[model samples]
Target: MAPTIHCVRHAQGVHNLCTANHVIPDPLLTDLGHEQCAKLREVFPYHDKIDLVTASPLRRTIYTALESFEPVFQAHPEFKLIALPDLQETSDVPCDTGSEPQALQQEFAGKNVDLDMVHEGWNSKTGRYAPINSALRERARAARRWLKARPEKEIVMVTHGGFLHYFTEDWEDHSQYQGTGWSNTEFRSYTFSDEDHNADLEGHAVDGDNATLVETAESRQRRGKVGPTPDRAQQKTLYQLGTQSWNQQLSTEEQDSAKVPEGEEVNGVRV
Candidate 1:
């Protein structure tokens, strides 16, 4: 079987809470983001199945991986942490601009991040730091190719929301959200084509048609958040079925409403 790539959006960053005219360069995670990272240990169902843990070079993503997968690292010391600059957040944004490799190593020396694979000054933009959609697309493509070349069968990456949409090419899934981006600590799974010939010289294009998105525990948790919104028809149906099993007295109308309703809001609102 082909490897399963698990892309994880980093926990909330200070910049996410407050964006200034000057993008805060390589911001750290907010307290809420740290809380979310801690919850990932409980929410990530594939803890035992993961073969490796990789992350963007940015402080937020690196910290997310360190916090979220602490147990995995303890159990499987062989799975070293790799800091991939190619997988770093889009460079056009100020917050996404990473620190120098030496500085990062100095700042995060206690972490088990392997900086050898990262290119020198990989996240530094040459001209100006401004969010450019096209540039981000190209960077995502490069990151995809790099990930495809990895030997591990199951991999996890902690990265940024701005780059994830382009990386996964699943804009429709997140487009409805306020920022059209994923929530903090959101983890998604995708299965790529096993045949390397399917990718062009630039590797897989932004076309996600070839990839299959699988639902994870994190996604389910997002959907189950209690709010004023209408209940999901699937959840409602399952509840009715359970009632029938326990009380043996569900009404026909109740049973009929179990079917998933048309145009139901999904992939919206953060939990």
Candidate 2:
């Protein structure tokens, strides 16, 4: 049986404060971010059930996985959080890009986090890591395949907002203007679709099919609301916009800020 995956967006990072902070290379979580993780740790219900935890190699995500699931790590001394490069954000901006492995190792020396999968050039935006639509799609597929092959019965993946849409292949509420609808540290449970089970993992059969994550009914109930399903055109548009170059997207965001009223705010940040 496929693992029950819980997808979580990392808590508030410095870049989440405002567009200017996006220049802060691989910024850490803000104080509020840590506080959010603490709340998640308290509220998260599957602490004992999770067999493994994984996160994007970015510091904010690593910290989120460790802090939010600290109980799981503490209970199982044999497990270490696996940092997967494929789980990194879709954008190539400094804030989204990761740091060197050595620097991360130094910073998280004593932490129960593994960086073996985060190889050199993993942070580079070139090749498979590029923010192009094709690359992002392939990366998301590879991540799903990897998760399906894991032996764990349950898993947690702490990742970024923009990339979550791709990873789950769910764009029902995705907004090109606002990015993902997922709030910081918010998570939803999912399981591999039946199509995923039927497709041949070793061959290219899964490539043509939409072998993706299916949000559990319980997760939907937990969310308390479900928007209308997006049409194909809308999904395509959202995916294209979401996968655009981060700098280009940031420029668009800056241009849009001019339209905001003086006292109004965008993304909880005063514009």
TM-score of each: 0.69, 0.84
Report the lDDT tens digits of candidate 1 across residue range 186-236: 787766644333332234354442332334444445656333222233333
Tens-digit lDDT string for candidate 2 (1-271): 9899999999888887776676789999998889989999999999999999999999999999999999999999889999999999877668888999999999999899999999999999779988766677778888988998899999999998878887887765665334666888989999887743333312234545455677888887788856434534456665555545233334324534534223323444222
**In model 2, where do residues sit more than 4 Å from their true spots?**
196-210, 226-271
Among these predictions, the greatest TM-score belongs to 2
Query: Once model 2 is optimally superposed onto the true structure by TM-score, how far is the C-alpha of residue 138 displaced, in angstroms?
Result: 0.5
